[model samples]
Target: MTTIVVGVLGALGLVSFFHLGLFDLSSLLRAASNLRQFILETFPPQFEILPALMHAIWETIQISFAGTLLGLFLSLPLAFLAARNLFGRWVAGAVRLIVGGIRTVPSILFGVIFVIAFGLGPTAGTWGVALYTVGYLAKLYYEAFEAVDVEVIEAVKSTGCNRLQLFRFVIVPETANTMISQLLFMFEYNIRASTMMGFVGAGGIGYYMVGYVQMLQYQHLLTTLILTFLVVMTIDYLSLRIRSVITVAKN
Candidate 1:
């Protein structure tokens, strides 16, 4: 009875909040006609630009892969230093503060800053993506590190293992699978993000996407969207397969 009461209250609260926010169905109903017109303009995708778009797609993939790898490399040490069980609260707290600060800023803002510094190119996009990855991955890595089994650490210490040996033989081995899974997840996320890189003048397929929209070339935009969708779907599929293999191996 208590659970049911709480659920009903929560539902009521959500509805009340939406009402307070001025939620209305009229706008949606009105937009249906606009949506129909927009669809008519977007059909029959322009395939003539396929070659150029393919190159842009490849570049997007490259930027995502490079950024994710760079972030992973940087995150490993940061997370190691931030692990409370390994480094104590003071060290972990300081590192967490830094990671939190990084995470506070959005990746697009980083793209803007890097675009200014690097002057509009995939270089800026890659760095922006890397920094974004570092912010999330470092936090994740340290949490995983701290979750290491206490008994295992103690057993390793009993063998006269040094800090490095303990980490290598116990902590790392335990967390290896998790690290790989996280890396793959981040890579998938970065791909989606890299598509927006062009909005900030950082190069990617998004540059063409922006161009198409500005030029009111919805047909071209539709082509880009389709290609992007296919690419993202393929990456998602591959990541799923990789994660599945890792899960099976771990089991």
Candidate 2:
């Protein structure tokens, strides 16, 4: 216990030394004053920019939907091929390696690459979100596919079903509800990600956010931020309701 306490104190000390920097009261007070001034400038938010904000919100939804659909389409085949029950060890390992590598890459990097490839706009953002989602969702879905009960798979096989038939009729059926539910969750996550894609010229509300910051339009910036928060909350609430209904139906 004494050794553990010392170790914990050492860890905290290192974190304070490196991460927190010096505890300067003057710096803290200055930051707080700046924050107060910023808030005062942001009061009531610029309601006049509602149309532009709405349009950006719509575009964000579009990017998320398109990307998630693309990921789902691409992930399904790769997931089955990577399933140990369906493929040889070498094939599965190679596929998993590729997927893992993709997941290791940051999403913003994907946006940057796509912007370079396609030039600035929604196209770049859509592709970026799609590629990242493929990397992320494939791993989750492959695991779900692999977890399908062996007895159920064998039962289907006894009917003389081929591998493709087995997946279509048995595995997919068993996992369809889960797949749809997860896709909605992915859409919610991608909405937040899409907002920042515009920073790389990939497109969305982020450009306006940049503009507001550059112009010192604190009111407009606060409005944009609030809109984003509301949209995310709405998505979360809707996703929860939909998933609950799906779960009940599946049961």
Candidate 3:
């Protein structure tokens, strides 16, 4: 017991030392100083830009919504195939490989590539975010499927139900809540990613933020920050409400 305790303490001490060295306090202080200066300069926001900001906010919402909707729909079929217990080994392996390939590419890179391919607009941003979302949702969804009760599945199979019937009557209902939860989480992430995609000329509030910062339009930057805060808060609240409703229904 003494040897085990000493080993655990030694491991923890190494971790602490690593954190102290890797996360150097001096470097953090320098970054914080720059951030403070930026915030100070952005005070007294430009309220006049509210109309334009509102328009940009709407575009961001549209991008997130479109991407999330497409990802959610596409994931439904793919999730079943990817679930190891539900499909043949080859089929499941292929689906997982595709998902892994998608995940390996960053969303920002996707945005850049689509921007070049589709030209400068939300089309590029929407598609980029959607592709990323597909991989993200599929991974979580397959896990949810794997977690469902095996007894329920076997019972449905014994009832002479085919694969499609089993999926519809047993799997879908059992995993519906988990799937919806994953989708909502994806939308939350997409909202932030969609905003950042605008920096690559993909059409959202991020485009305006980048422009304002480049021109030293600090007041406008502050306004953009305010709009982002409001939008994020609203989405978070709605997500909570939806999650609660789903939980209640499931219970």
**Alpha-carbon lDDT, every model:** 0.91, 0.88, 0.88
- Give the per-residue lDDT of model 3 (tens digit) for 117-216: 9999999999988888988898998888888899998988998988888888888888889778778878988999899889998878889989998999
Q: After superposing candidate 3 on the true structure, give the runs of residues whose Cα lies further than 4 Å from its correct spot.
A: 1-37
What are the TM-scores, per candidate, against the unseen true structure? 0.88, 0.93, 0.85
Residue-level lDDT for 36 in candidate 2:
94
Clash list (residue pairs), candidate 2: none
Listed per candidate, the RMSD to the true structure in angstroms reads 3.0, 1.8, 3.7
Best by TM-score: 2
Between the candidate structures 1 and 2, which one is better when assessed by lDDT? 1
Clashing pairs in 1: none
Candidate 1 global TM-score: 0.88
How far out, in Å, is residue 134 in model 3?
Answer: 0.7
Comparing 1 and 3 by lDDT, which wins?
A: 1
Worst 10-residue lDDT window for candidate 2 reads 17-26
Candidate 1, 20-130: lDDT as tens digits: 754656766767888898889999998898998998999999999999999998898889889987888998899999999999989999899999899999999999999
Off by over 4 Å in 2: 2-15, 18-22
